[model samples]
Structures are given as structure tokens and as C-alpha cells.
Target chain A: MLITKDIKLADVILQNYHLIPIISRFGIKFGFGDKSVGQICTQYHIKTNFFLEIVNAFNDKDYKPYEKLKNMSLSLTVSYLLKSHYYYNKVKLPFIENLIDSLEWEGEDNLKNKNVLKKFFRQYRKEVNEHTANEETEIYPYVLELEQNYNNTGKVSVSFLEKLKTKSIKDYADTHDELNSSLLDLKNIIIKYLYPAENKDITVQILIEIFKLEKDMTDHTELEEKVVIPVAEKIETELKKRY
Target chain B: MAVKFSFLIVEKSYIIRSGLMQIISNFYETGVVNELHNVDTLLKKLSEVNADVLIINAKLIAAVPELILDIRKRFEQLKLVVFAGTRREADEFPGFDLKISVDEPKHLIVEKIQSLINEIKPKKDNNLSENLSEREKDVVKQIALGKTNKEIGEALFISPHTVITHRKNITGKLGIKTVSGLTVYAILNNLIKIEDAV
Candidate 1:
């Protein structure tokens, strides 16, 4: 499918229904009327190219947005990523945790099993929190600084950023830890082993939440890995060449 | 019949080891994975079992610098992957067949391992002569290089429609449509070098 700026947001959503959640996150509503993707995104103050790149990348498995993404602002990409992190940590995680907490587990063994599930979730949440926190506190700041440095100086020395304990963008990527497997383990325990017959409804609810969070996290990481890092590396190469 | 692959993992962290095992189990329908905390047991196990792959942690490799070469000499067919926690660690072990940062998400790691397995044990029936025509192979090489269909047609003195037809035929025969997948196939079949494809 051809994805040009002239296409309406409503049309794009109609073509690829999976993009509804992603586009909706940017606060664009349905019934966009006659507004094109370019217009709506500009109205919402979203970077049109970045939005198109992301949407197209999501829609087409073969689409590689890295080259087009280099011309786009890193700050916009970083901000979008930061917002996703916020949604995951602040909104989705707590909602799931609350669901788990509200479920009734009868008898001592069931209570024990519930506690185990809770403990596993807590551990997983802690890992995710730390991971996102690291990106927010360390990686994103470093990337922003690199961008600013390059913009202000017109040329940045690798050693200058290294002095601030910020190496290349690749270094930040290297430090990333695999997000925990406890979520899967938690799902397995509940589905295959722990949940009693009567608690099927709650179990289904919890699984749905978990599945949503997993997909969000996967998409978030893919953006960072495939789009953000490559763009950053390109910037780094450009800066190095200038120096 | 599927080839049953066995993995020997040498990681210091029990959590990571178990996590890797869980991911492997989920990814592969038939495989055996044995984990060891240190280098000595890994060596002992290597002697007894013909593991298809050795996934050693970079930290352990650092502690025993000779382990990689030692294993290479003994098990010439075994694929070596250095599972690194950091890029620095990964950089240190450049000699390994692959250096995967443990930082990569689980699905990516599984995908990487699966591709590696396919590389090691390529399907006999999918050989280029039997499946892909010579013309289709040429189209695949161009596709893998990120060439547009128009560009490919220009190069081959064919119409864009002809290029698309060849692409469809190639995808049909190979059962893979993505350019990345075609690139991998091209690389595996020696149609294009890795550097050129990249």
C-alpha cells in the first residue's frame, strides 16, 4: 500500500486496523474528516515524517524506515519513546497489578500461589521500572545532549561526549538489559498451573492485559532498536566525519 | 525430519541461564539445553556430549581466555556464541561466530538463534537449482541490495512488471517474501557477499 502524506489518517487506519492504538496514542481521534495525515499530525504538533515512518513500518514488515528517519528529528523520536515508557510504567503496569490484587484466591495454597504470582509480577515490574528509568535518566539525556552538542558546535568530538560519561549511541544500546522473562513465567503459572476453575474470567482479564503490555513493549523496543539507534549511529558518523 | 539441536550454556547468573533456557524451549520444538555456572563443567560436558552450539557468557570467556580456542579445536563443528551483558564484553570476544548482547529482547535473540541454526543445517530440498531459477536468483540479489524494482528492471534490461513477476515466483518457491529474508538467502547461497548485501 502506498503511504503518502496526502492520505487521510482515517484511510490509513482503515487499511491497517492494527495501527489504531498506535495512532490513537498520539491523541488523534477517529472521524478525522477531510484532514490528511500531514495535516492532522501537524495539527497535533507531531512530526509527520516520523509518524508516517512509524505507521508504515508497523504496517509493512519489509519497510525499512532507517534512511528516511535520519533526516527526522531525534528529539521527536525520543519524546515519543519516553511517552510510551510513561504509558507502560504509569498506566498499563499499575492497571494489571491492580487486577491481580483484586482477584480472590481461596484457601491457604491458593493464597500462597497468588502471593507467588504477585511476587513474580513485582520483580518483573521492578526490572521494567529500572530499565525504563535508566533510559530516561541516562540514555535519552545523553542522546539529547549529543543532538544539542552537534547542533550548537556544528561538529562534536567523540571525546567531548565521552568526558560526560556518554559515549556513542551504540554504547547506550550495549548497556540495555533484556527486559525480564517473569511476565511470561507469570502468565504460565496462572494459565497452566495456578488459576482455579472458577477464576477463569479474572485469568482471562489478566492475560489480555499482559498480552497488551507485551505487544506495546515489543513495539517500543523495535522503534528504539531499528529506528532510533540507526539514526543516532548515522548522526554519530556524520559528527565524526565533521571532526 | 527436524534436526535436533543441543545447546550448552555457560553463564554465571542462574536467572539469566534459566531465562535463556526458557526462551530456547519456547522457540524450538525439539532441543536439549544444559547450563553450567562455570567454565570447568562446561568443558567436562563438551567432552561427553556433542552439543551443536556453545553459548558461553563473555565474562566466563574473559576469566578463561583459552576456552574459546580450546573448544574450537575439540569441537570443530560446534557453533560458538558469546552472550555478552555489555558491548564492551562483546567487543572483547570478537573471535566467536556470533556475539549477542543479553540486552537484546527475547524474541530477537530467538530469531537470531533460529537463523543461525538454519545456516548450520540448511534444508537439502531448498537448494537454489531445484527451487529458484537463475533469473530469479539475480532478482533476489538485487532485492537484497535494497534496489527498487525499477532499478532492477533497468539493470536486467527487463520491464518492471517482469521483475515483480520474478519476485513473486522467487517468494513462492522460497516461501519467503521479505527483503531481509531474501538477503539472508542470497548471503547463505553465496549469491552476494555480506558486505555488499548490507
Candidate 2:
């Protein structure tokens, strides 16, 4: 089912609870008695269309709105990405790490393996922190500047356009492939390699959370690669021709 | 028959690159295609993509003559294809696993790629059961009992190499990679007691 602006926010949550965290990233609070998605977005002063596209992308695996996505502004997209970084570092990573710490190992070998997993996850968290930090300090600023320049200039000179190749997003951002794979490796290690406490439910929960994070991270990267980069590249090409 | 293969194409010309992609995708039920326009990115891309077949333009190979040999050394499983527009251009890169003349009929081009895959594919057993075989179950029991590979080999009266192969097959079949994970599986399956696992 395609999520639309007029759909009741309450009903949307009832249909897919996975979108709750995604919606929260938009600075939306609960207690929506019976408001529509558009009304809630208007309350929060969020762009309702962008919010719908993001939540829809997160909710449905097959929903890729490339044409609509390319039309999104860097400021809006980057703001959403920054909030996702906050969610991961503040809410998701810490929660997973706490769950991992709470897990009880049955044997010495299992304890050793658990230590490895803990170390692996800590390192993975560090990598993600570095990646998002790089994007914030580096990629976002460059794109926002490019966008500002894109708006200002039909008078862009030939020499300035020559310098655009080095400024391409491909050089800086590899689009989170390493981060994605490391997390997948961690998930597989838990599922296939390590055996935790006999109750096993905590391990299952940990796996489920990792799986969800992986999906969310994929959507995040695809938005950058398929949408943002293309738009940025289009701007670069647009700057090449002079008025 | 449902086997899917991944491919990497290195061509500078957009027309040829897109043309090749369209052809391969049209032919296969599923295929992963990665493209690079220049040799500058080839080595980095090759390391990342892990493609089964590399259909590279002959000119790119000519410019970097030792690249094919280097790729062969690193990725022993990778099959090579010379993507030449003319037969004579392809002849310069002789002894390749396959050649794709972009002008070839669509079906013929696909057939050449499929034939290379057939030549490289490992033999499959007809009795490829989804479940672990009796021998594999016995191996899991021995693994849960904390037996080393040599110990398991001695107990099973099989060569250590054969035992290792069985262990790999067991991992593939059960999706349990570690001995401890297999121990849990063994205990759950009644192949071994919980106390034996501990």
C-alpha cells in the first residue's frame, strides 16, 4: 500500500510499526489522536512530501521514487540524513551495545566469541561515527555550496567548470558499502558463528535490530547515491554552460 | 539452469557499455552487472566487485598489456572476455575464455558467455539433498563432542581432508559456521546431549 499525505498517521503506524523510528527522525511526536500525515507534518513544520517519500522508502523495500527524489533540495535531504545519524548514534547503536553487554555466555569459548563480537561492534560503531562525521563536515558542505552556486550562476566560467571533476561525490563518499558489509558480517557472525545464552531470545532480538539497521542504512545510502549525487552531478553539468 | 552469474564490463564508450548491459540483462533471468569506463578505476573496482566474468574492451587490455595476467593471478576463478567490435581486434587478444563482438546477434553473444560459465562451473552431485547427510550428522555429533578435525577424522575413519570437506558442506547445509553454533544445532537436533556440548 502506498502511503499518502491524507492517510491517518495513527492508521499508518498500525499498518507498519517499523516506520515509527523513521517518523520520529522528522521531529514528530506521538499523541496524534486522529490527525492525517499531512496535518502532523504541518504541525511539525516539515515538508510533507519529503517526509512521505522517506517513510515510504523505509517502509516498502520495492519503493524507489528516483524522479521525485532527484527533485529534493540538499538542505532538506541533508537535514534528514543528520537526524538519521543522531538516531543511529544516540538510540540504535547504544541500544544494541547494551543488549550485547546484557547477553550471558554459556562457556569460555562462547565468552571469547562474545568478546570478539563486542569488539567488532564497537569498531563498527566507530566506523559509522567516522563516516557520518565525514559526510557532515565534508560532503554536505560541498553539495550545499554547489547548490548555492548552482542557483547563483549561469555565468559560471570555463576554468571553474574544469575544477568540477575533483569535486565529484564519488571521490569522497564510497556510498557506505564498507559500513553496510561490516554490519552484515556482524549479523552473520551472530547468527552462524556465536552461541550466546540458552534463552536465545536476546540474541534473536539483537539480530532483528541489526537487520532493521542494515535496511535503513541501505535506504540512506541509496538516497545519496541514486538521488543526491545525480542531482549534484546535474548541477555540475548545468554549471558547465555559460549564459 | 537457474544459475546466475555476475559480470564487470570495462569500456570507455557509453554506447558499447550500455549496449552490453542491455544484452546481458535481456539474456539472463538474474545477473549483477558493474561497469567502469576507464582502466584507471579497473583495479580498484575488480577488487571490490568479485565478478565472475570480466568483459573488457580489447583496447583497454592493449594499453595495459599485463593487466589480464595480473587479474588472472589474483582472481583465478574469473573468466575473461575480449569485447572487440571487429574479429581482427579480438584476434589481438587471443586465448581468452570468450569474446563478444558487440555486432554479433543477441542470442549468439549470450551463448558465448553461457558456454564460458559452463566450462568454469564446478561439478554438481545429482543427489544434492538439502538436509545434512548421515555422515554430516555424525560429523556434527563429533564436533559437538569437542573433537578436533584430526580427532573427528580418526573417529569417522575418513581422511582429515575429507573431514574438512564434510565440515565445509555441513556449514553450507546447516548455515552454522562455528563449532559452538553447530554444537547448539547438534544438541537441538538430538545428535548430541547438552552435557556433551558443554
Candidate 3:
């Protein structure tokens, strides 16, 4: 019963990725990310508020916002890495903000105080988008083949990772590292800017939101390393086999 | 209790999906049809799964002959039906055990399919030549020779597109839709010499 319940929960949890289309719409309201999100949000006619609430909740200072954001960010990172391939347009920086905007709002004032958050958003977005583009253009095709052939062969091979370790994969991983560092720098700025002594309810919410955002960034990177990379490697192996 | 038959549905368009959903809904209420999007998936499912009837989408019937051949060869007992999108397409893939167009009313498909199953019930085995005509066979042979429509047209004295038209006609008749299938047919029928193909 417990395993069944857990499996059901996993199914429900995975369904959240389906809502990326909806969450992406908030990018228009906040001008969060790049043109890619804007284009998709418009085409899909995704509702913004529902996604914004999720983003705000992830970044909320009260409750278990940090842990929640980490879980959410990992889900989102995987979803974006997977879903971006379906689109012809490349996923770029503001897309993350678009994703974040749907999950939690750190409040405008918090963003203003920790201006590094803006810089991080800007830099991280650039780096992440570039990384995503590599995956989309080169890596994703291999992954799709793996998915298509999954029924025939139940194993993932390491040759895909070996392929990734070549120049193309290293370039992507380098960009990921750069973006991750920007996020850490942004976290430091937010910590320095947080003045709990002079805070109000809005300030408290902002701090909680920032904390969640920081935790999420870290979690997102780890998941990409652990799950996404391995999946990509499996895909690479499948691709090599096909070629 | 006349025997109830199972059909596999394959298509990409929403219109086709909705129409199929409606027709199957009317007949059985429990939608047993599988809407396949690509050849690989369809082939895998067809080999692994069992069905009493095969209702192929027109687009798929036009796109993958190897898949059709494979299915027909393997599942000889299953009645093969073509749910073509247009009357022209219906005429193209000529001798399906039962042929119905997507534009046909739900009742029309239901009725035709029902009657087809009853008529061919015991001998559900599908033969590749059921749909091909003598002329269509000639066209496929010419195509396997790697003749351009113009060359084939010059030889057959038909327009290039007409050669194309005949080729399409041949594919429909043989239930072998792909160029590769036509190539294979050309080789098998000794229409094109193997050295010429090589």
C-alpha cells in the first residue's frame, strides 16, 4: 500500500512538469526572462497567476520554503532540460526567471536590496541558456532516441557520457558551472542584504523567498549532475549505437 | 452474441482522433483503439499486442509500407481495414479488407467495418495483392528501376506526375507504401534487374 501510494504520488509529482506551459506565462507579467518563454507563453495562452503563486511559494520565507524550492527547482530543471527539446526556439536566461516567477516571488524590494540577485539572474540566465542550447541542439536528439528504444533495450550505456566528456560536453558543463557560481554569488548578496532587525512582514517574506531561491539553485545543479547528466549519457550511448 | 472485433487506430491529427474516438465510442463505449503516431511505435505495438482487426490511418497507410507488410505478414488472422482521410486516398490504398474514409459518417465506418468482419470473418488473413491492379504493378516495377517520373513517363508515355500518381496508386494497391517497399517489390517481381538497382 505504501509503495502504491508512493508511486501514485510520483505520478502526481511528475504531472507538475505539464504545468510549465502555464508557469511560463508569468514571464510576460514580470518581463522575467528571454524571448523564448515569451513566445511559448503566448502560443500556449498559459495563465500567469497560477504559475506565479507556485514561484512565490517556492521562495516564501515562512514555512518550509527552502526545501520546497529545492524540490521544485529540481523538478523544473529536469522539466526544462527535457521539454526545451520539443521547441524549435532555444531556451535562454529569462526562462529560468520565468520558471522562478511561477514558483516564488522574492519581492521587488528584496531584488533591489540584493542587486546581485539581478546580476546573478542575468549572468546565470546567459550561462544556463547557452548550456541548454547545447543540450537542445546536440544532446537532446540522442536522448529522444534512447526514450524511443527503451522498450527494446532496458539498459543505459556509458559511451554517451564518454561522448559528453568530449569538447561539446565540457563546454556545456563549463557553462553550467559558471551559472551555478553566479547563483552562489547572488545568494551571498542576499544574505548580506538581509537585515532582519529592520524588517517588516514584506521583508520577512522576501528573506524567506531568497533563502528558498538559494537552496533551489544548489539543488537544481545537483540534480542536473546526478539525474540529467546520466540520462543524457544514456541518450548519447543510444545515439552512438544508431549512428 | 456475434463475435466482437478489436481494431487498432493510428493517426496524428486531432480531427482524426476525435472522429475515431466518436466512432469507437458509438460501437463499444470502451475505446480499445490505439492511436499510434509513428512507424516504430506501431510496429512494436503490433508485434507485441494482439488484435482481431487493424484499422490504419490514411496518413500512416501512405507513409509506411514496410510496417503494413510486417503487420499483415505476422497477423494474417487479423482483418486489415484502412480508414482513409479522403475518397482519393481510399481509392489509392484500394483493396483493404474494408476501406472507409475519415469524412464518412461514424455509422458508415461502423457499418462497413461490421459487414466486412462478418463477410471475411473466418478468412481474416490479409493478402498484399488484394488491392493492387495489373497497371499499378507495372508502375511499381518502373519505380524500382530508379526511373525518374519523366523517364518512367517517357517509357510508359504518362506525365511525370502521372508516373508519380501511378506510383502512389501502386503503393495504395499493394499496401506497401514506402519507396523502399516499392524498391523491394521491384526486386522481388524482377521488374528491375538487381545489377541495375545496385
Instruction: Compose the digit string of candidate 3's lDDT tens values, residues B62-172.
Output: 766666777777777777777676877787775467788867876667887667656655453333344456666667777766677788889877788887777655544
User: What C-alpha lDDT do the candidate models reach, one value each?
Assistant: 0.73, 0.78, 0.51
Better of 2 and 3 by lDDT: 2
State the TM-score of the second chain for every model: 0.58, 0.64, 0.52
Relative to the unseen true structure, what is the C-alpha lDDT of residue A169 in candidate 1, on a scale of 0 to 100? 71
Candidate 2: tens digits of C-alpha lDDT, residues A1-243: 899999999999999999989988888889989999999999999999898888888878657766786787877887888899999998999999988877876665555445545665787788899989988898887777678778773565554455664566557657476687577556655665455576588888999999999988888888888877778777766754532
Q: How big is the RMSD of model 2?
A: 11.5
Worst 10 residues of 2 chain A by lDDT: A108-117
Q: Residues A1-243, candidate 3: write the lDDT tens digits.
A: 111111222232244443333244233233333334324344445432223334343333222223333333233434543543233124433444443333323454334323323333554555555666776666555445444544345554566445444523223453454544454444433343233323345444544544544454454454456555565555445555564
DockQ (C-alpha based) per candidate is: 0.02, 0.05, 0.01
| Model 2 residue pairs with clashes | none
lDDT of 3 at A198: 38
Between candidates 1 and 2, name the one with more favorable TM-score.
2
| Candidate closer to the true structure by TM-score (higher is better), 1 or 3 | 1
Residues A1-243, candidate 1, lDDT per residue (tens digit)?
868799987888888887877787777887779899999989999888788887887777556676777677788888888877887788888888887876776664455444545655675677788888999897788677667776886655566656445366777754333452455445544554454734668778999888767766766777788677776677677766665
Ranking by lDDT: 2, 1, 3
